[model samples]
Target: MNREMMKSLNLKYTKKREVILKILEQSNTPMTAEDIFTLTSKELHMSFSTVYRSLSALTEKNVIMKELRQDGKTYFQINSHNHKHHIICTVCGEVTPIDQCPLHELENKLTQQTGYQITGHNLEFCGICPKCSKQAHNK
Candidate 1:
């Protein structure tokens, strides 16, 4: 499947790229380049630079989504066609995917009002998660 996706994107298929994509596919939450590097390193001998470059290429092609959160780290995840947003815990860096897009109606309204084509959008909410809030309250 990863091979076909690369072929469709006109990206040259490489084992390293395949491993990276597999790692992202298996992950439930967004991962930093370092996180991917650690996992990829466990599976095969690959450098951090190689992993980073693969991520960049994939992100540029929209094969994956890149998000920078309040924690100051960039995270990557597969760009599913269903399209979803995320909410991050500002304290512990937990990422939770939001299945429903809250901005679709707003996007339509904006396109109608401004007469501009809305191609895409990115939206993420950040706040203390329940666990973090509970921990803080306990303290």
Candidate 2:
């Protein structure tokens, strides 16, 4: 979490945001707002709207990233500075961060072929996870 993020949101360093950031930093996987709400409400007795508000602020400042799935639910995760993509499991919604950009070469080639300036891209690979595949086989 950066100081500027809080300042840009016109918010000070509150215990609420700190807790939220701590949770995100410690999590091994991305989590939905509902997941965070349930846990934080239990632990901090925070109001649902407050949690939502803080999440919105964090997201707006890019302190956190939001991924809206096909299910219409948005999952939130801490934003790392590295450029990364995700591979999602359609069966179980498991998401794995991909370190290597699959389209890096293609992007370079395209840049060479055309003079158009490329800024950014979003890439997601969807498939069944290993655990889901195993479960399907067992069934």
Candidate 3:
């Protein structure tokens, strides 16, 4: 992805934003602004406020997804473009995206039952991941 898309959306792209996006893209899961800044501050010469501002802009342009985790910290990830929900590990904060969309049928059912058109939905399942489960079992 390039800044041209953001330009079309009337959002100015910056190198700081690019570096942040790259970090989010390279990460296997979502990242907090603090975590991002900690990793890139030396190389990017930016502040926490700068990282936060870039994240807000990226989210505004729909270039990334921001989610408030149970930890009360906001996490960001590269927008997949394909709508998918995440299943998060409660103990370790591991977020895994599931491609299986179970809402299509549920949406149809809800619309048929209530006669109201549903525009969108969000579903995030939470549970202990295998690693956490194993650790618990060993203890």
In model 3, where do residues sit more than 4 Å from their true spots?
112-119
* Model 3 accuracy (lDDT, Cα): 0.84
Put down candidate 2 lDDT per residue, 23-130, tens digits, no spaces. 888887778988888878756878878888988988887788887766678888888855568888998888898878899888888889997688656677889999
lDDT values for all models: 0.89, 0.81, 0.84
Q: How good is model 1 by TM-score?
A: 0.91
The TM-score-based order of candidates, best leading, equals 1, 3, 2
Clashing pairs in 1: none
The reply for model 2, stretches above 4 Å from the true place, is 2-5, 8-10, 109-119
Q: List, residue by residue over 41-133, the lDDT tens digit for candidate 3.
A: 867699889999888988988888887766788888888876668889999878888979989999999999999998667677899999999
Screening candidate 3 with a backbone cut-off below 3 angstroms (N, C-alpha, C), the clashing residue pairs are: none
Query: Which one wins by lDDT: 2 or 3?
Result: 3
- lDDT (10s digit) by residue, model 1, range 1-139: 4677689988989999989999999999889999999999988999999999999999999989887766778989988866668888889978888978899999999999999998788788988999999999999
Per lDDT, the best of the predicted structures is 1
State TM-scores per candidate.
0.91, 0.79, 0.84
